[model samples]
Target: MAPTFYHRWPEPVTEKSGSMVQSQCWGWKCLSFGLILVVLGLLVPLIIFAVRANSKACKEGLLAEQECRTVTRLLELQLAQTRQDLVGAMGEAATCNQTVVNLSTSLEMEKARGLEHLTRREELQREVEKLKEKLQKASEEAERLRKEKEAWSKQGETSFGSSSKLLSPLMVPVCLFLGLTALLA
Candidate 1:
């Protein structure tokens, strides 16, 4: 006959079943823990990177805002300075215009005075010419009168000479009257 398989003691079914169940439970727990660890690892770096990016963006925005404010302040200051310069230039131009007006007035006054002086000088020159003419006429008249007197004196000497008795006293009076008439003429 074939060698018969000997029947040994029966396997412990409860123990084997319990041990398998425990192993399966432990495997699921280990898998869940590993998955959790992986997720946390990924999330930690992502969160850190996001925070760093946000911080950099905030810093850049703040710097830009500060620069804008500075530029605005500089523009305002430049505008104010330009306004002041314009006002000063206008004031200087006004002063120059007033000076020009004063100079014009002075020039006009000087011209008028010059004209008056010229007129006065002309009038004086005319008066002097008139006086010279009058003097010349008077001198000529005096010279003519002197010449007539000399002629009468010569006639008297010739007609009445050296003989007061020959011409009588009556003739002497007549001769004197004639001499006076010639002198008057």
Candidate 2:
């Protein structure tokens, strides 16, 4: 027979050649798949770590913003309270000033009344002094009249011894008249 296709490409040679090529191709394919799997696994963890870090940063920023807002509200409240206190203090000071003015006016009125009373008291004292002087003069005049009456009665007694009994009777009448006049005066 002439050289056939099967004979030229013999069984042993074909088997050996095809087996080596197939094994090497299959091994290289498996190594490529393993490398792909490892790269995918590493990417999953890295993606998870990056997402957690970003979330944590966002939460911190939100917390800081809330704190700042709370502080701002507190400061506003404090400022308002201070303003109210200042207004109250000013009102109290005005009321105190009015009270002082009223007290000063009352003091002036009281002083005027006291002066009027003092003037009246002085006038009454002068009237009392005048009455006392008049009483003293009346008492001195009464004493002088009593001494004159006593002297006239003694003269009548002395004259009665030398005169007649008729003269004695007339002298009694005269003495009676003088006594009456003195009492009347």
Candidate 3:
């Protein structure tokens, strides 16, 4: 026969309530709890690292956004200044164009005046030439009349008698005076 141990009274059935302390399930509960603690322990550091990385990236993104806004503002101001300068340059160019037109008109008027003065001077020169020719012809006529009067006086003195001689002497002085007047004129 094998040695056997036996109790006279029956033990209580504590496992039916599902309580770990009263049952043999304490080891299983402890094992499950330990597994959860290990998983949380590893995940906590991973979550902390991800959070730090996200925070740094957010800060960098904000800084870049601020810099972009500042650059955009500067470009807009420069564009406005360039536009203003362009407008001023256009106005100056318009004024210069008007000045050129006015100068051209004044030059045309001056040229016309110069032409008129040249025409008047040519007319005066033509009139002077005509007057010089008329003056030369008048001088030639006076000299021919003086020669004819002297020949007539000598012929009249020989044809008349002694009574005519007294008249001839008086007429001689008168003819000489008239001849002198014609030459002076």
Candidate 4:
């Protein structure tokens, strides 16, 4: 009869007759150990390659970071310089604006003064015209009196007998002329 499932078992190694070397029989245990060794051998070289690549990448990253820091520091200094320049420019602009305001105010004041001066000049001109008119009138009146006096003197020489009446009217005209001249002057 064929053997049943529970009755089956692996046979053990027995000594070989007429052989000098003993036969080895480790079975599944040897196969599993060899497989584990092959896998570990492949993983060791991959781990070394990964470590070298990682270290190289880390060095490159450090250099890049240092370069970036240098650039950032230079940019920061430039920014500070630009800010100072801007502040100086703004101060100059403010000064210029104030100067412009002052100039405008001075110009306006000068204009007002000029207008006032012009008004004074006009008034002076009118006064000069009035004085000239008064002077001309006075000169004409003096010439008329001189002509009248010449005529009266000639008549008095001819009519010396009635000199009292002619002299009285002549004195009145002369006095009035002198008074007008004094007032005009």
The most accurate candidate by TM-score is 4
| Per-model RMSD to reference | 19.9, 19.6, 16.9, 10.7
Give the per-residue Cα lDDT of candidate 3 at 96: 95
TM-score for candidate 3, residues paired by index: 0.45
Writing each residue's lDDT as its tens digit, candidate 2 over 121-159 gives 887677656655554455454445445545656677655
lDDT of 4 by residue, 1-185 (tens): 99767765755544552132222335455877899899999999999988886897877998999999999999999999999999999999999999999999999999999999999899878877876776677668666866766777776665643564566567657756765675455
Q: Among all windows of ten consecutive residues in candidate 2, which has the lowest summed lDDT?
A: 160-169
Candidate order, lDDT descending: 4, 1, 2, 3
Clash pairs of candidate 4?
A: none
Candidate 3 yields a Cα-based lDDT of: 0.73
lDDT of 1 by residue, 79-130 (tens): 9999999999999999999999999999999999999999989987776676
List the pairs of residues colliding in candidate 3.
Answer: none
Off by over 4 Å in 4: 1-61, 157-185
Tens-digit per-residue lDDT, 10-109, candidate 3? 5465675456454457787788899999999999999998888689787798899999999999999999999999999999999999999999999999
Candidate 2 lDDT (Cα, 0 to 1): 0.73
TM-score of 2: 0.41
TM-score of 4: 0.55
After superposition, the stretches of candidate 3 with alpha carbons farther than 4 Å from their true spots are 1-65, 139-185
TM-score of each: 0.45, 0.41, 0.45, 0.55
